[model samples]
Target: MTEEIQSKKNQHPADGQQRVVIVGGGLAGLSAATALLGRGVSVDLIESRRQCGGRAASFEDSEDGSLVDACQHVAMGCCTNFLDLCEQTGLGRFLRRDRTLWFIGPDGSRSACTPATWVPAPLHLVPLLFGMNHFSFLEKAALAWGMVRLAVRQKMSDGDTELTAAQWLHSRQPERVIQLFWQPVIESALGESIDLVGISAVRKVVVDGFLAHPKAADLLVPTEPLGEIFGEKLVAWLRGQGVAVHSGRAVTGIQYDESGKATGVVCGQDLVVADAVVLAVPWRAAKRLVPKLLPPVDESFVGSPITAVHLWFDQKIFDLPHAVLVGRVSQWIFQGEEENSVSSEKSCRAPAKEVEHHCQVVISASRGICDGDRNELLETVVNELQEIFPKARGARLMRSRIVTDPTAVLSVRPGIESVRPHATTPVENLFLAGDWTQTGWPSTMEGAVRSGRQAATQLLKMTDMKAECVVKDLHKNAFIRLLVGQ
Candidate 1:
């Protein structure tokens, strides 16, 4: 397929213009191409998979032949780069913003925690914390204090301490608060257990994700399937803008001249040439291709697992759209809505599908869970839902699936910052972009976009064209600026 398409399109870089070859079709590679739009540089984006969105992709349902997300991906308002890329590509309209975050307590109580829209930066979270029905007044107070302490004082924790989030919380916060609040929140965000995630990551979740701006916590969910939003729409947009998107082609290795400068990539039987290269694949793939260009990835990084439980019932069981489950095997539950039919065939106006009883439960850091027993895990999740929603007890389950990504995210351990490489490599023309890189963010869609844009920026500079592609952080108000000394 790649060879047939390669013969038709002008795959080579046009003469005289600096050409960039992006090696992966994930958010990182896609963003790298988008960043170079109208920059006088030609881009050839090669994606091994047929679809573009890497991890953030969808699968075809076996029964109905429709789209189902491999996992539910959401964006917090703090994800500036991710949101910017989506909006700039006109994919933002497909996003559904949920102002209120629903939290299901241990005792099956529901609380709607919504940050005050008009309130000041730090104070905007006051209503959000106090609204949690699960916590007592004293527990809430302690939780608030702990958040401030983590955000202000301990955010600058010394790298030598090697403190985990669990250790820091347990020392300063009450045990109940640690279990009921910090455990689930931190795990869900970092995709690692609180005991395993570093305190620096937790600080990022609090400060940039929560305290940075009033709108920072707003949740943006895709109304359309991720496959269509990224794999189809975004890809079409990039192609229309003259970016060469070569999908279904696996790049074997990087091509370098004797000077150690990247001249192009080896895709299948073709040596696709370029003046510069953006290696935007995951760490494992990057290390495999250019082993000497990276640090000892075996020691520098580790992956965290995430599981998604897809359940279909005869009738709707969940009353809320989405909720954060406290102290349970199921970390978060999303009540599936009738998804708009943005078919892979490029039917932009097809009739929307009326989905029924279709919902997803996400479990992060699910190592040692049920001892790798799928049946037991499914039973526990179903029973937990039945306990919380009486409707679920009687609803007949039609079908179910358990999807787990063993290495879903980069585990942000203490002292990890030292090993996280920058986009600029010693090879001069070859740049790196991935969520695993040093983007000052977690391994998320946001981090991937930032890394790609940063790589593009550095590459443009190498071509003697100075440009700033990565956008600035969200605007912080005076109070936040003064408090954080930003």
Candidate 2:
């Protein structure tokens, strides 16, 4: 049976605890391992990469050697499960919640939209919707009504959901509203062009993200670089929990018995024996390790690209914490928190030089930008920022880099829901976990965490152990419940 793949000899549980081997150290795998804590389970997590965190990751600047995120990852207050994990793991202190979302209009108009916590559910969004100074009064009203319509819209059939969001929005929303309000917002949230994404996905963003509660739209941004937060801090927490974390260890295949039940995973030249396995890697990787357990990775599943342009200026140019630039190539701009340049180890002391102010421009769903020309893309982005912010015109560009993740997020495309697999696989001992899985949410941090917790719970349920890690969504007030008929 172990001829095709290497034999996975069992590493028997030392204390009669259930041995759970998670073959991935991303957020999903990390969360799954966290859930098994104190549940009479022994957990071991293995990540192929030298560091975990997967897409929510960062890289060292080639010139300055400072760490910068590939793309900014933000959490919403609606991401109950992700927030809970952060809080549970002591990573909550690293999160900085920005209540105001700054929107920059085409005419250089700036609007700071902040939802009201004191106000009732749907009404809380009234201030936010009306605060868009770029839109006319009628345009604002139209946008508000369109949101209500989408919120109340019931789930469509699989065939009907295959309609693209742009197709559905063109008929329901106004031209200007679709361009200024819906396009940028939806693209930023979904990480896919509205023309390519499915309608049902947009509905979820509107309902769970905006209408659920006053704080649902609250943005939880990490104060530190994601590399340190997840790759280092998160891994340290897992290690402290008595969970064996093996970074830089890649699992080549999974070993199953005659009944097709997984016994262990073959990592490198070693086999991590386990009573249960959580294949928490991406769909492509999952399919590679256990081909018999998964379907072909075809057009049914795809990824959306996200690009982040890192820029260092001689001085601080933009003052806002973050800005959402509409009607431009830039979707979101964040002020990097790094204040000091990377210190050289040979110097034995830090050298005094002009402190370069760093900022990043994030473009979600940025496919074929400037005809795939990096210089042109950079020039256009700089010009756009200069046009929107007067201060940017005088700032001297120091060093810059364009980072693009071609397959950053799972594309919630037409009819993709039917293809997303459940946590429990056909093999009784194997469970699946990743953002690409069906988590009733888009390809987001919340979805990834929920997927992991779901897989953990499924494993726990099978072992007849306590399995409660998934957190509830933000509370929907009675008014919202009645409006959306939730």
Candidate 3:
């Protein structure tokens, strides 16, 4: 586990002890605290909201006695950070099923693509040769060729170029291929259009999804609620380690020295002192907090909006755990699995055995769906699902809600790469940690966890260097090339 990895060296200040303060209680913030606390450092985590987990938060619907994951999120097979954290917290065992993505078209056409085995180099082009859904065999083959060519070309040029994903792909391959396959995936991954998204950022998703591991594309949705699997467990673990965590204490201001080093944070009416501080909030919140911390970078880090539609049905409308729906009211639907047990009147009981029971459903990357007009959106999904599943025509709507974050993720457009902050910032005792930062992966749960690990490692290194009078790069020259010239 990263906890022990960062704990080996208990580097402290001249006073022989140090305290670390982490802002935000999301995955990134909690992960940072876990890593820092493991290294024998006292830690304090403050969350501005009443609850933690940020976008990853969940709650029990008092109306149903069933858990509701706000937007119905899942992890992919390539999510190393999620896997590591799961293992660390012993939550890995709860991951129950591997689902093959079913891409359903508006006309009721269906295609199931299971996770492919990972292979390196030329042989990795097998799936494309066979083709899937809209793409022809020839088109798929060409697309595969284009990806390899681009990967090689990127290695050769190695210079950070400013170009949208649409421009880059169109320049290399046919426009139709990108419109059919690339556009849909890109919009879902980065939460924006290809015309505005960056080529490098989109390419990272493709490379990691298609080139990295065999099962990288497979969907891993936990059978239980997200909080049950990780969030609650993580909080318990942190508290067990003697780390102080305060919820609903939003940071109003950051106090810094003349050198621009962060000394502590100002929450509401309290000033909390610390040896080091990590700003692990979302991109939108982070932009508000440290706009001047990194020069020529602040403006680019601001993000685009992402919306999620949560709909509950009277029965199981879509039997599939999760599927990507193209040419529909929504891009994807992640159906929550049956809860292990339900509580009724303060007593635990098995869920009612009936087909006409409440079922959870989440629609991802939905657009043109009015938040106030629930009837309009509900009617639309009902009509759409009826076409796909004739039996769904009888499914009655119980309730529906829309969740949106105007800045869910940073715009992955061109030239934005340079704006992403590193684990260690110019401010000596302050660091940046979030999915938007450079975690190699795209804006994902894995990326967020990785950023947390990076931040913790960095804070520890700074302390070590100060104590020993020697500078050692925990990343150890890995970022030198990117820092100097490519």
Number of the top-ranking candidate, with lDDT as the measure? 1
Task: Give candidate 2 regions above 4 Å deviation.
Answer: 1-9, 154-161, 338-352
In candidate 1, position 225 carries an lDDT of 80
Across 1-486, the per-residue lDDT of candidate 3 in tens digits comes to 123212322343335568788998888888888777556677878888766777776777656565667666677766766766777777777675563667665466666665444544234336533435756677777777776655444532226566777777876777766765677777887777777877777766665555444555656677667775556777877888877777777888888878777777877655677679999987667767887765455556656666666655666677776666665666677665554222222333444533323334344333345344766766776677777776578877666666666666667777666667788877888988888887766677777888888898888888773221111212212232232232
For every model shown, what is its TM-score relative to the native structure?
0.95, 0.95, 0.82
**Model 3 misplaced stretches (Cα beyond 4 Å):** 1-16, 96-99, 116-131, 154-161, 171-176, 257-260, 296-298, 340-374, 465-486
lDDT of 2 by residue, 152-253 (tens): 874443454567888878877789889888999999999999999988899889988998899999999998889999999999998988888877778999
- List model 1 lDDT by residue over 362-396, tens digit each: 99998887248899999999999999989999988
Once superposed on the true structure, which residue ranges of model 1 sit more than 4 Å away at CA?
1-12, 155-159, 340-355
Q: TM-score for model 1?
A: 0.95
For model 2, the run of ten residues with the poorest summed lDDT: 339-348
